[model samples]
Target chain A: QQQVKQSPQSLIVQKGGISIINCAYENTAFDYFPWYQQFPGKGPALLIAIRPDVSEKKEGRFTISFNKSAKQFSLHIMDSQPGDSATYFCAASMSAGHNFNKFYFGSGTKLNVKP
Target chain B: DAGVTQSPTHLIKTRGQQVTLRCSPKSGHDTVSWYQQALGQGPQFIFQYYEEEERQRGNFPDRFSGHQFPNYSSELNVNALLLGDSALYLCASTPDEGFGGYTFGSGTRLTVV
Candidate 1:
């Protein structure tokens, strides 16, 4: 089962536009949600993460909006730039015992920003 | 300090052969996990090691196995390799304490012919 599901397999946006990717999870036990950005030939790098306790967390141009009641979350990039073009993955994890460290990742979204 | 380190960035092997991939966790980290990523697909967990023991595993078959040493470095051994086994193998590390995400290595690309 795909515990985490992401939408918009690929996206193209004009420079300075807002890029949005959405994801949802089925497991209510998930308490930690994180987004990762990956460039070609490299490992996925953590972008921003939010816990169920908060509705939104932002850092620089990247923001993660989470809804625990809905088991949904999204990553919004404001003023998108060419440098932001890359594959984005959304992941969910549980912090309890036994499975405290494993992450369930979504398929991924390939974003391309045109200047 | 060095991040997670993986050896032999790339490898090629024949079907039915056995291959071993290695990983060294980030300095001071005691837990290591392996993931497999196929082309155009997200990573799939293989297994995790802690305290020189296999603590958790994914849905992979028995042909996929691993071991962890006292130093926390780990090795993934795949026996009877198949063409479907070709993928990028990634190793991630995290400290046992605190609630933080894992740090991943560049990964070892394995091609099975």
Candidate 2:
């Protein structure tokens, strides 16, 4: 079963507009939620992360709005640009003693920013 | 300061053959985990190693095994490759099981024929 589920398998946004991607999880044990940006032929890079204790986190133009009670989280990009076109994946991880950091990733969202 | 590094950027093997992939964790990291990503699909966890021991594993078959060295590097071995085994293998590292601090390598693409 997919522990985490993401919506909008693909999205296209106009430049200078706002782009959003959403993800939901069923496992309550997950405490850390992170967003990764991946370009073609490259590894996924950490974009932003948020803990369950926080309702929201923003780094530069990237923001993660998390709803702990709803078991959902969403990433928002402000003033989206063509450079933001790439695949975005949302992942969740929990610390469980020795096995502490196994991450469950979402199916992934392909974002396209049209200039 | 180097990030996770994976060897054999690309490989091709026969269906009956066995393949081994290597990974070197970033400096100061001690945990290594392996993941398999199929085309257009998210990565699936294979297993994780810490302190040169297999600590946790995902729901993969016995054919998928891994080893961790004292140097904090790791290797993933897959036996009897199948066409479905063709995918991008990723190696990730973290200092410990914390809330964050995970890093990933570019990945090695494996093609099974």
Which candidate tops lDDT? Answer: 1
- The alpha-carbon lDDT assigned to residue B67 of candidate 2 equals 95
Candidate 1 local lDDT, A1-115, one digit each (tens): 9999998899999999999999999999899888989898888888988999999999999999988888899999999999999999999888886777888889999999999
- Worst ten in a row by lDDT for model 1 chain B: B96-105
Q: lDDT of all predictions, in order shown?
A: 0.92, 0.92
Alpha-carbon runs more than 4 Å astray in model 1: none
Cα lDDT tens digits for candidate 2, A2-25: 999998899999999999999999
Q: What TM-score, over all chains together, does every model reach?
A: 0.98, 0.97
- Which structure among the candidates has the greatest DockQ? 1
Fraction of true contacts retained by every candidate, in order, equals 0.51, 0.67
Model 2 agreement with the true structure over B1-113: per-residue lDDT tens digits: 78999999999999989999999999989989999999888889999998999889999999999999989999999999999999999999988734574789999999998
lDDT of 1 by residue, B1-113 (tens): 99999987999999999999999999999999999999888888998998999998889999999999999999999999999999999999999888778898989999999
Tell me how far the alpha carbon of residue B42 in candidate 2 is from the true structure, in angstroms, after superposition: 0.9
